[model samples]
Structure formats: C-alpha cells, structure tokens
Target: MKVHERLDQELSKQGKTQAALAEAVGVSSATVSQWRSGTKTPSATNLVKVAGFLGVQPSWLSYGELGGKTKTVDPKQRDAYRRECVWYHRPAPQDAGRELGNAAGFAFHGGLSTFGRETSQNILDEAQPGQPTVEARYTLIEISGSRLNSFLEAIKFDDLKPHLEAAADSRQKVAAVIRRGLSALADDGRLILLRVEDYGAKGLVGPEYDDGNYMAVVRNILDSFKGDNAGGSYGLGKSVMWACSQFGMVLINSTLSVAQDGKREGRYIGRLELPWHRLTAAEAGSPEAYAGPAWFGEKDEARGDVTRSYWGNEALALDTYLARDEDQPGTSFLIVGAYDPDERFQTIEDMHDELVRALAANFWPAMVERAGDDPGMMTALVRSERNGVTIKSDLVDPHSYTPAKARMLRMHRDDLTVDSLEQPGDVVRRRITLEVPKRLSDGAHGSQQHEAVLLVTEADEDDTDANRVAFLRGSHMVIREELVPGLRMGSRTFHAVVLAGLAAGGEPADKAADRFLRAAEPPEHDDWMVTPDVSSSYARGYGTALKNFRIEVRKAIREIVGRPTRDLSDGPDALKELLRINPPTVDTTKRPRVKSAVGKPDAEGRWSLDVRVSLPAREAPWRFSPVLRFGTDSGAAIPVVWEKLVPETRCTVTGDVVVAEAGAREVRFHGTSRADTHPVMASLATALVDVRVYKEASK
Candidate 1:
C-alpha cells in the first residue's frame, strides 16, 4: 500500500489533523506529509511516536502488529553504539610496535569526563636543544593552557620534595646517621644513590628557557649524546629538568678526579639555579656570538634577577665548595611545570628512576671507559620512604667500598698475548676474552657477581659475530675454531690478555664494542699481534674503582642505617633522631678520650671485622652425555657411566676400561675415565676448601 494512503487511513481512523499529528510526533506537518508521500521515511523512533499518536502500535504502522513491546532499536545502530563504547574503553599502546583489538585496546572518552582531557604528550622535544636559548643553561617560559596545564600539573612531585630536602638538609644528618650506623665504614666520606629504569617512551628534556626555542633546545639536549652536530654535546637528562621547573634543579656535582685536572677537579656543591624570564623563537644560539655575552654590556653574567637568592648562577670555585663545609657539589634536579606521571609512575623514585634509565640508555658508558653491561654503570639504585635525608646504601648495595684496588670489575676487552717467557717474537694465535668477575663484583644483586662469569660466548657459537654470553660459576663453556686448551685462575685456562681484557686491565668496552671481553677482531690493516687500548685499560680501572667505591659506600650506608624490621616503613625522622647524640659527660682531668688499649692492634692496625663466606661442599655430579635409545620400545643396552669408567680417562688411570656392574652400586666413582674420582674437586676450593672441610687437627 502507498504510504500516503496508509497514513491517510490511519489519520482518518484516528480523526487527527496533520497539525495535531505533527505536534504529537514533535515535528513539522511537512515532515509528516513527506513520510506519507514516501519522499522520506520516518525514523524508527519517530514512527513509534507517530503510531502512538495514531492509536496503533509502531509494528502495525509498518510490518505487523505487536502484542505489547515497543519497536526495537535499529540493529546497525545498536551495533554501532556497542562498538563505540568498546572503543572508548580500549587501551593505548604500551611499548613500540603495539597492536590493538585483541583483548585490550582503543578507548573513547566521555565528552564531559576527566578522561576526556587530552592526553597528548607535551613533547618538550624541539628539533634543536636549547634553540631558543644559548648554551647549556636554560630559562623557560611559564607554560600555560588547560590541557597543557594539566600535563604541567601532572609533573608535580610530592615525592621529589623529600629528596630535594634531604639533598639540602645538613650533612650533619647525613653524617650523623652514616656515622652512628655505617657512614664510618666509607673510606671517603660520602654516599650516592642511583636508580635506573627506562623511559617508557621518549620524554621531554632540556634546561629552563624563557626563549621561544623550547622545542629546539629540548631536541638538542635530549639527543646530545648522539653528538652528530658540530656543537658541544650535553646530557639533557639534566637540562630538561631545569627547564620546566620554576625553581631550578639543584647542582651537587662532585668529581673524584685528583686535584691536577684543574678547574673541573675536586669536590664541589652549590645550587643550580634557573631564574625565569620571557622568551621568543629566535634565541637558541651562542649567547656571546648572537646576543653578546655581556648583560646589556653593563653587568657580567648578571641577569636582571641575578642578585636574587633563588637564581641558579652562583659560581663557586671547586676547592672552596666541598666536604668540611658540608654542602658537597653534585648534580641533583627538581623539575617544575611538568606533566604529572601516570599512576603507574607515582613515586619520586619512579620519576627520577625513569629519568636515570633514559640517561642509562642515552649516555650508555660505551663512550665512557669500562662500560658494564646494558646498565653501563654499576650504580646503587635505591627507593626510600624515609625522609630521604637518611638515605645511605644498605650493607648489600653494589657500591660499598674503596675507590681503588680489588674492586668489583666489569671486563670490556682482552687479547690473547703470548710473549714466550724465554724467546723473542715467538707468537701464539691471539684470543679475545671478556670477563665479569664474581669475586671482584661489589653490587648486591638479583643475579650476583658472587658467582664466576654469568656467561661466555665464542665467535662460531654466536652467529651474529658478537660475543654473546652470560656466565655463572660452572656454566657451559663455548669454544671456537681459534681456541687452544690451557689453564686459568681456578678455571680452565686460556691467556692472560684475555683475562685482563675481561678484568679491566685490557681494552675498555667502548660504545661500539660488541663482545663480552671487548674481544673485537682488530681491523685487518692493523699489524700489532695484540694491543689493548688505554681507554679499555682505563675502563677496567674505572670498573675496579667503581666496585671498590660501591663496596666502601655500601659499608658506610649500612652502618648508618641498621636493623631491618618486619615493617619497612620507617620514616626519615627516625633516621634523623638516630643520628642525634648528646655530648658525653667529661671529667676534663686527663683529656677525655679512650684509655690505653688493653690489647695491641693487629699487624694492620686498623679496625677489622670478621668476614664470613658459605661454601657448597658437594656439587651434585652433573654430566653431559651421549644417549642411545631403543626405537618404539623403552629399553636399550648401554654403558652405565655410574658404574663404568670413560674409555679415554680409564685408559689414562687404570690402563683398563673395566668397572663394577651397573646394579652393584658399590663403586666410589665413575666417568669417561677412572680418574674421575676427583671430578667434584672445585678449582675455587684450592685455597679455602681446607678451612671448611677439616677442623685444624686439634693440637
């Protein structure tokens, strides 16, 4: 039937005028007329209203009559809305190359919900770092905008506040706590905390800048380590922190360089200030070359607010700013006006650690001598709920000791050098070696250096041409076409250069090194049979220094904060109070001090403490074997190594291959050879096993 006829019939039956129907249906009469003429179709929702106005159910207006229910929504519409809701709740990418739609993915925000706030990253990334400003120092504009402000607010760090306070609070607190507990344990007089975690994605970084060049500046600084340009490279991990902050990052940078390096040598401490100012798009260049270094040609390094205490421009000479005076100099940062991190990164340690990790990747000690693994430096990363003022290494931190000697070491490179003890020019094939020593390693760990090398790799074994490996006390050993058998420090031997290479006395692992021992094959054109670079050697030295340093520092920190509890929530105030001490009463008669010692000091004459070590007595016999299996059936006739001697070793020991029968189970030992009785003799026990296994023949 024609829609007009049907509509006319309906209207006639209902006794309703066009205007009345239009009003009832909440639309113009023309719309109703068009629906009737079939020029346009009434929406399903509208049809239902029309049917109600016409005294009929919606189904009767179209297909058929309905008992009681209202017409259903469009299937396509229902599907679309359901899909839209799903999209709204979907998750974003977590890392790179992520895909959506499986379990979790894209989500839409409610127009008025807090989730509706734009989450676009505030890319502080400018093509050129400090493009708006000149030099490493930055002075940024006060960022403003709703979303921008939200991001800016997101950067606020309540956790960072305690850390900043601790960095500034009297070293007395630092010292007292360290002294009362472990500070005295440090050979030098300081402690450091390092935390490393990756920046999930590239993040904003650069110093403060009032100039419009924020974008360029950020890019330059963040990518500074790339060193692709003619300009000086900077570590933006620090700079960006300075930029977005109202108050500048604190500068506590200290150097352990002996006094000779001149201006950069020694310990120093001071505030790294960034006073705020306005900026424009044209200023990212050398200040002297472009704007003229002199401030208005009147004041030198004098910014308008130069005299303000909050400014970051105080320049203290190295010698005068450290140690005894208390405020040691080192790099510390506090950012202002930044996007707050997501809940996933709610703590200051998280934020700071993320920045550090970015630095770990960006600055990777590859450029520095003696780089260690992917982490680069063996830093002691710590997270503290204690008011930060009491932060000190636990006794087990990686960094616990001496700045030199017997330190935890990371091997970067090594070359097999055989200078025949008695002959000249008598050469041997060079072998490269990389070693991460379990003994010299200082850091407490998830996977500790307490064991020998965690891994090892040979050229042929690793197809990529890289020395890929992880080592443990008795892990599988990889041999190569170039290998020759020998003996080494308690382990199978190879060459000293190889050991040195891995031990910090050989070639240092630089940014480009690919092998564990920095055992790179020298370019064909080079003629030296084996040569280790000074850089590599220095790297070994550095690792040694770091290991020792960590040990020393950790020793001190542990002494400072002792006594672990079921509750790890001790506040910083507890540490401060622990460090406080009232002076002891004195008679003043004979110079109040310790009386003469009842016992003479040891030959070393220094305070010494007992050190303990636990050794495994019996390592379960582990054997790699050749197997023979019966096809289909579960039985096979084979030599039982447990009862028989190995063909080769048996000939060497007993001159025969005979042994006790398999079921007898009475033999003392068995192996590829009869001499295998001593197989469990761990080489490391050569010096110390006697101490643990036997009581000193009493009298």
Candidate 2:
C-alpha cells in the first residue's frame, strides 16, 4: 500500500474524517484531501504529526514500512502524552438543567452481593463460543503510602479530585457518599481497589462510539445490546460497578476476541460518573460547566475532542494493576475507591465471602458441572490482597455451596431424574407449560405453549434455603425463588428448580419463551412479571400467563413431594376424637366460620397457620376479624396476637379483618402468631383460630 492509501485506510478505520485530521494537524482540509488523493505528499514534520495523531509510527505512515504497526508510546513520554491524554468533561448544554447525580448508579443500592451477581451475569452473557467454562475472578487490593500514590497517579487522580470535591461541596444526596469516600482516603491514607476479571468470554469490541458492546457499556445509558437469552437486558448491570465505587469511577481493560486498530489486547479506558458542576476559571483555565460524566483516555480531536480508549502496552497495564494473568479474551474492571454501599462488608474477608456467597446463590446452576465429562458454563473465584500479599483466595465451588441445587442440575443434565422421590438424593422431574402470549406484532391467533422443566429433590438437612422453588431461564442464573405454597403439613423438605426457555434443553418454543420471559423481567432482571416491555410487546393476557406459570410450578412441586394423608386408624378413637374438631357446619343464618386450619412452627418459633373460612354469599363484602388462640389440654385457651396475615385467595386483609371478596363463598388466609406473645413454645401448643363479626370496639 502507498503512503496515501495507508493514510486513507487508517483514517477510515479510526472513524476519523479528513476535516478532523486536517484540523488536528494544523493543516487545511484541501491539503489533507489532496494528500489522501495522492496529489501531494506530506513533509516530514506534518507526517510525524499526522502519525502521532492517528497512533501509528511515522515510518509506517511515510512508507509501507514496519508492517503498518501501531506505535508503542514510551512510558517516559507519558507526561508529554498526558497533556493530550486527559480527562474530558462533558460540557452541559445551555437549554438543559443540571443533574444532581447519576440515576443509573442508584439502580442498585451498592451491595457487594449485587456487584458480584451483576458482574458475573455480564461475564456469562459474553461466554465465548465452544468455551466450556467462563471464569470470573474478584480481587480486592488495599494499598497505601507510595504504592497508593503511584496507582492514583496512573489513573490521573489529581484531575478527578477537583471534580469530586466540587460535587461533594454541593451537599446533595450523592454527595454524602462522595464525602465518606474522600474522608476514608484522606484519614486512613489507604484505598481499596476491586479488580474484576473474566476469562473465556468476548471482550468489549467495536468503535468507541458505535453500536457494539464497548460503546453500549462505556458511553451509553440504559442501552443494552444483548440478545434474548442474555441475563441483563436493561444495560443497568454495568452501573452497579460504578455504584460499588465510592468515587463513582471504574477503569476498564479488555482483551478483545476480535482485533481493533490492529490489536486484540491492552485496550484501556476509564469512565467517571458524577453530577453536573462548574469548574472555576482559575483552576481549569476557563470556567466550564460539565453535564456529568468524564472519560480517561487520549483526547480524540477527530471526534469533537472527546476521550477515546488507548491501546497500551504490558508496562502500562501492570502500572494500572489491570494486567490479566493470561492472554484471555475478556474484560477487567477496576473499581476505584471500592467500598460496599450498604456497609454490610467492613473487612476484606467480609467482602470476599459476600462475593462468593452471592455468586453461588445466584449462579450455582451455571457453575455446576454437567454429567460425565462436560464442564459447567462458568466458574468464579474471590481473593483479597494487601500490599501485593494474598490474604485469602476462595474458589467458589457450586456443589459445596449449594449441594442440593447443584445435584438437581446435574441430574437434569444427565437425564437421571425419576418420576418421584422415594429416598434421599432422588431427583424428580416434571414438565410445566408456560402459556406465552403471541406478540402484538406477530398478528397470530393463539399463544405458544412452552414446556418448562421442574426438578425437585429431598434437600440436605443443613440447607437453609430448602422448600423453595428457584426459577431460572436461558442464563441459568436464578431469577427468583419463592417458598412453595399449599404444601401439605409435614411435607418433606426439598429444593426445586424451574428451568424455562433455553435452560429447559432448547425446545422448539424455547426462543419464543425466552423472548417473552426477557420482556417480563424488570431492569433488575430479578423477577419475571408483567413489566412495561411485556405489556407493550405482547397481546392481552400476558400477565395471566405468567401468573399461571408460577401456579403450575408450585402445583407440580406439591404433587411430587407433598406429604401423604394421615391414617386416623393409627391413633386411639378417643384421642383422635378429642384431637380433631368437627368440620364447619353450613348455616344460612349464622356468621362466617373457620372451615379448616393447619399450623406449623416456623424456624423462628412462630406458629404459622393456613386457615380457610366459609362465608355465606352476599352482595356486600364480608367484614370479619380472624382471631388466634393456643388450645390447652387443661386450661383456658391462651390468646396470641397475629404478627402477619396474608390473604391467599378471595379476600383482602385489612388490620385484623378478612374482607372476603363480594359474593365469594370461601376465603383462604395465612397467618403467623407473634412469637413474643406466646406463653409457651409454638411446638408445645395447638393452634386454634376463629372468625368473628367485626364491631367498632372489637379487639
């Protein structure tokens, strides 16, 4: 390629216009255009300037020499380059008002667990094709003295300190958090940086401001370019990284699966999110009003003097503490001034444990190994360091952390599930249908029935989250978990998994179901319900479909693990008669009566009861208070206050009254007695419940 050809190619590849190059090189557009057209050759001085502007070697640009390789700028010249490579604060427009804080950062409450879950989901979403396992490692490092200063200098903390101080001076809600972070660094002279690295995944690729993962994550807000099966659709997951940083800053280093600018690794950039503020003319050389965010990179004069990512070398990566252990295709995020927003994790140990626990709890299925020789989708590790010394390194083992669920997933993958659980470790599989309504855009007549899988097995005695059904879809990350309702008393404690969409072995309707479920998820991606996306995209009855899907899942669980009916013949007749009260009698003239009641002692020693009431049909809603008392064998019944009452069906609970739906015959409500109000242990007492007509002075 000729000199003009190489120049033209670099210009096009870098998304730089001839006018931009001309302006940056202090030359006329006509001159640069002529040089591109091979009508003129640049002088040595302008050629070097042009090469520097385009990040190429002068010899490579002057001739087809050096294979047109990128210039590796020396670290000694960093200060000289720093003059051009500085933070670019976005100027606030005249018409718009100022922002107090970044709304996206507030999407999460800044818990370390939230950080782990969100970051891991992003890694799994970017899993490389044919890669057996995507690995995510979390490293927390505390540095002070010269080490801290060197790190801060690499990130140009001096340029950022002024902005942070200005934002904190405003005394806004976000400023309070900024103040605390500043105080910690100034008082303790130590700062903790959390570096999150992922391996075996597609890194942030594409142009700095175009439609790709890099732009979507770094430059935009609420713009997710993920596919239907991706765990995050809202694009708010990345904001949690900034939220975890007390200074609202995160630096990124990515090794791309696909090359950009003739390089595949050492892509470095930093983004700081702050509120609108103004810098004094004395400090900034000119009074400037900023709209909020700022970028740390070489100034791209081609794109309105905005900052774009720099292609650095190994030395630069090491200096920033973002050097990856291997040449893996993934991205690393370094959260500056890292601290748990909720303050639940104070020590490095607490943060490490929280990350491991969070990753296991939310992503155990993804970490579970398949049957036989196949590896799981992902693995994770959490470690802490102080001044280059490793304090703790924990490899999150899904089986060890969540044994029951992991076993259930393995059985599912191996097709080793049975029809019923007859003993310990027995896995039962059932098919539940999710009625996915046709999209409004489809113009179809009926809905697609997506078959979802439900796995249930007897939980280990030590499992704290037993007797709950965990719901997951394509990502294999738990979207939500709920205690199985309507299970019979003394039902075997078990763990259940509901696999929908692609997680259910990629059925014919998996794609459609995945799309529908993705639409149902909120920005948090924590639950599936009738969200705005679902309401606008799908036809009517989408909400009912989701509700039915949940109901069917619980019903299938009950059928597989519900306790069998007790045999009355096993007990003495007199004892049985005394123990069992007569069923509620039907009478048109009488008030409502309690038809059935079943009570069990919860882990907290509270008596939890499921009660059914029969009310005579009436035009007006029935108003009655449900009272709870402990039945004694030889004394008056002991009264206990109702701690919580939730209406299960055909009723609305207000205070102590159960208002049956108008014209409703039966009402089902669940209530728990206050443990503190109990005279004896809940296990030692029999629960008695009754319904009374509401009166003004009733108690």
Candidate 3:
C-alpha cells in the first residue's frame, strides 16, 4: 500500500479524524490532508508522532510493515521482520556503496541496559591508571535538535525513542534507541549527548594493526609497555572512555599518518561499540549488519572488495560531525550518550577539576617536562568548558603537591645526583642504582628531616606525607613514600626521599648494582620487591643490592648528624687543650665566664681547687666534663678524682664534674689510671683553668 493509504487506513481503524491526527502530531491539518491524499510525506519527527497517535509503529506508516507484536506468529519472528522492514524502507542513499544498516547489527542479543552512569563509572575508576597520552585540547560539545536529524540517513534507524530504554534481557531489539533518546534531549536542552574533540599534533586515527581490524587489538595493545619506567602495568586506560558512554558506544574520527594512493590520504572514521548479540558468522562479518565492529569511512565501490572499505574521511557523516576542515592530526571521540550527572563529573567545572587533579597526580612529571617515556613530548589539556577554561599542569594546584613540587625539583636539578649501590654483575646488565638526588640544604637540615621535592615525604606507606621516599622507574614516580624497614633508627623515626633509576654512579648496565635496581622493579612499576629467592638470580641480586643501599643511607645520615666524643690526655699544655675542646662552638658574645681557682700546690702532692663558674640558666642543660692536661714529664703518675679517683700512671684525668648550687666545684688530682699505676698526688690552682662545658652541635 502507498504511505498515504497506510496513514489513512490507520486513522480510520483508530476512529481518529484527520484534524485530530494532525493536532496529536503537532502538524497543520493541511499537511495531514496532503499526507492522506499522497500529496506529501511527513517528516521523520511527525511520522513517529502520527504513528503513535494511530496506535501503530512508525514503520507501518512509513513502509506498510507490521508492528513488533503478533498473535498467530511468534513475537520474536515478527520483531525480526519489523527490523528488516525498517532497514529496507530507509530512504535510498545519495552516496553509493554505504551500508548504514550495519549500525544496527552491532546491538547485542540482550539490550545494552547493563551499562549506566554508575556501572560505566566503575570501569573508569579501575582503568584510570592506564589512560593514553595525546598532546591536544580535548573538547566535549553538547549538541541536539535538527543536527540529530542530519544523522538519520547515515545511522538508518529513524525512531529511536522507544528502544532507548528496553528490558535488560530483551534481545534482538533495535540498535539506535539509546542514541535517539540522547539526541531527542535537545527538546529539554540537557547535555545528554556529547561530541568529544581531541585536537593537536596527535589525533585519534584508526589503528593500522591486526589486519586493519581495530577490535582485535584495541583492548590487547594496551597491555604492551610503552616505556620501561612507565607507571601502568596493563594498558587499559582507554576502557574508561567507553565506560563513560551509555551502552559502551563511541564514534572515532581521525586522520591517520598512513598514506594511500598518490597522496597522504589518512582520514578515517570508525565506531567502537562492542556487539550485544550472538550473531552468525556471516552476520558478524557483514558490514551491513555491523554486528560487532564496523568501519564507516570512505569506500571505493569500484574496488568491490575489503580494500574498498572506506579507510579515509570522505564520508559525509564523518565530515559533517567531525569537522574535517580543521586539517589537524588528532582524533575525536563522539560519546552519543554521555553519563548523566554524577558525583565526580556533575558539571563541566567538576569534570575539569577531577581530570586535572588525576593528571597532576599520576602524570605531572611528564606534563611539565620533568620526565617522559617517549622522546616526543606529550602533555594533557582538558577543556570541559566551551569558553576556554583550561587546566594546565604548569600552574600550581593548591590541593595537589605533585605538580608544584616536581617543578621546584626541576629548578634544583643541579643539587641532585644519582646515588648508587655497587654489586657483582655483568658489565652490561648491572641495575643496583638509585637515581633520586639527595640534597643537603640548611633550610632542609634540622633535628627533624625536611621534606624533599619529587620524593615521597611521608614515613607511612599508606599515608601521604612528605617524609618518605618514592620509587621512580621509566619517567614515572611509581611507588610513593614507601617506608624502608632497614631505615629505622631506634625510637627516633628516620625519614628520607629516595628513588632509583635504570643506572646510577655512571655504572654500565652490566654492573651488579645496575642489574639489581632494574631487576627489583615489578612489572607494575609500583615498588621494588627484590627477594632472596635463589631460583631467580635477578631477585637475589636485587635483594643484596637493596641491602647495601640501606646500609649506605644509614652511614650517610650518621655523618650528617655528628656523634658525641670523649677524649683525655695529659701534657704540659693539656689543660689548655682541654679548655679548647670543652666548647663545641666558641661564640665570643656568649662565652661562659670563669672565675679564678683558689688553691696552690700542697706538700701532700694532692692537686685541689675551688672553681667558680657562672652560666645562663638556659645553658643549664649543658653538662660539664673536666680533663686534666699535664706537662710532658717522666716523673710520676697523676690521678684526678671527682666521683672515682684515677691512678697516677695515667698522665691525664677525665671525669664528669658535679657542680654545687653555688656554682662552685672541688677537683683533686692524684695522677694515675686507678687500675694500673702508683698514685702521686699534686695540689694546684691556676687562673687558666678551663671551666667551659657542653656546647650545642650546629650544622
């Protein structure tokens, strides 16, 4: 039957007047009359409304086909027939050899209702660490209205409103329902649909691997390591992009670097919507069915083979929606149905903030040119706003410490040097080395360790603080602030910012240290887990090298922070030397005032003296130890007694001297090591007595 006859028949069956049908469809009565008289056809929008008004499917009004339900025949069979009718009845394509029907075939057996805002977001969270790098401005535009109608010819399925939401288990449903509803959202001015534009030197060109079948390698290629020191273990970052879209659907449009014909023709368009149905081999392979993955770019019908598949951007659909005139070499991701408002990406500002923060945390070093796995530089630019509110890594982010900290470290690179641990290994395969630079600065020196830039500054592995060390590999700071068990120092917590590189100390890769450092790194590049398991020679070597590094760090710390010293000597000028050693640091302005000693040599040979010393109360914490410096003599032993007397054979007497509340103390000297020699007592007093005690150690 003619389309007008079908419309007339449906109106009569529903007992609806032409005027009532026109009113229901938001059309003029004259237009309805023209449609009924076969003078004109209704637009795709009005056709759907008129069909609904007459209690029929739009396919019935447009193509004289039955609705999805049937009594005598099976409902599944009838639904299948209706889908076929819709495809065949689609208006003839002005462009030859383009199969728009393939878009519908990719729908799975069960509807794609399993994917939603929350479900998709979960996938994104797990896959964030592996996102790809493209230096470009990524723009997401919210579009609707007649702009959606323009896709009717390329996308084939016209009335997508009903199928937008179907039963989760309903299989063999139309493919375009979700897309239609998202496009229809123009009526409400909501940003349900989004077109993502990734612009710059690198675009989203179609993959040239896996025999030009991107599906075979899209998910698998991510597993390969882009760099030895890169942070991610598995390359699943792109999965997050699909997860953010409703029904795991997105259109990829980009110009490839591959050349075809005489020119560098590389423009290509493709769709990455995993199939929903369990299709037959023929259906899965047919471009018309588009049952799994499909290419929708320029095709040369003359070729009449797989090579004829449009691998360039000559297709009108690709050109109109993707802005082919930009002439840039980046790709655009068209997320037909973007996720609804969520906690993380509720508004454009929210999205901008979240993405920028993530980038700074994981990729700041690369973004700011501090480090990168590739020789060619790559940076991230997210433009969620239409008015150009861009987030850059070079700017200081108050909430995040990575970007600003890394930038500061780059400025002080001269102060940093690669510390290494030497070990036994082949000259070319050595790996026991740490690349993080250790710097000693007055501002960063104190009783408490100061935080270092580009290093984990926390002691707790699970906690975020500026007191620990980060393990660096490739160009990434893989493990942040991992506490080394061997670095502990009694009750005093030891903190440091440590890192290792591919090589240290100018050692070749064959050296044991170099091999150990590289061998200890896990595939994930998160931590150094060198073990003593002999079965793995590399692991054992790594473990040994790591132990050496820990010991070196301990030694270095001790040298930086001096230890207490105790020495005694007896010479003619020993007293003078003792006085000099007593004061750790001599500041003329704050020297301790020493009064005179009141005693002379006694006949009994016991040296005794009453010494008076005055010190500021704040210096009370400084304890004084006295040493006796005797003249060079072979005569007899001299011992000094404060708490215990020393024998005469020892020329010098060193002991802790107790001071009374009156700032006076008594000292008796009878020269000898109490354990070895005879005692010779001498009583002496001299104004040159050194009364200065302990001085605080300074850096």
Best by lDDT: 2
For candidate 2, what is the total of clashing residue pairs?
Answer: 0
What is the descending lDDT order? 2, 3, 1
**TM-scores for candidates 1 onward, in order:** 0.24, 0.70, 0.42
Taking the tens digit of each residue's C-alpha lDDT, what string does model 3 give over 1-699?
776999888778778898766445434466678889976655433454566567665544554421122224345533332333221111223443323223322322221121221112122222223333333333444433454444433443333222233211234322344444445454554443344443333332234433332332232334433333333333433444454555445555555443334233334344434333332344333322223333333333463322222334334324234434345444555555555323236454555455545445544443332221111123433444232222221221211344223422332232221221110000011122333211122222112111112221111111244233344433433344454444322211223433344312232321332233334554333445653321254322334445555555444533322222112233212234455655545333333332222222322333333333334334233344443322212422233333232322112234544332322232222211122122332312111234445554211
lDDT of all predictions, in order shown? 0.24, 0.78, 0.36
Judged by TM-score, which candidate is best? 2
Clashing pairs in 2: none
CA-RMSD of model 2: 24.4
Indicate the residue-level lDDT of 170 in model 3: 34
lDDT tens string, model 2, 68-148?
123454776565445555788888888768988878888875699889889999999999888777878888988999989
Write candidate 1's Cα lDDT for 498-574 as tens digits.
Answer: 12222222222311121222221121111112224322432344345324422432332222223232123433333
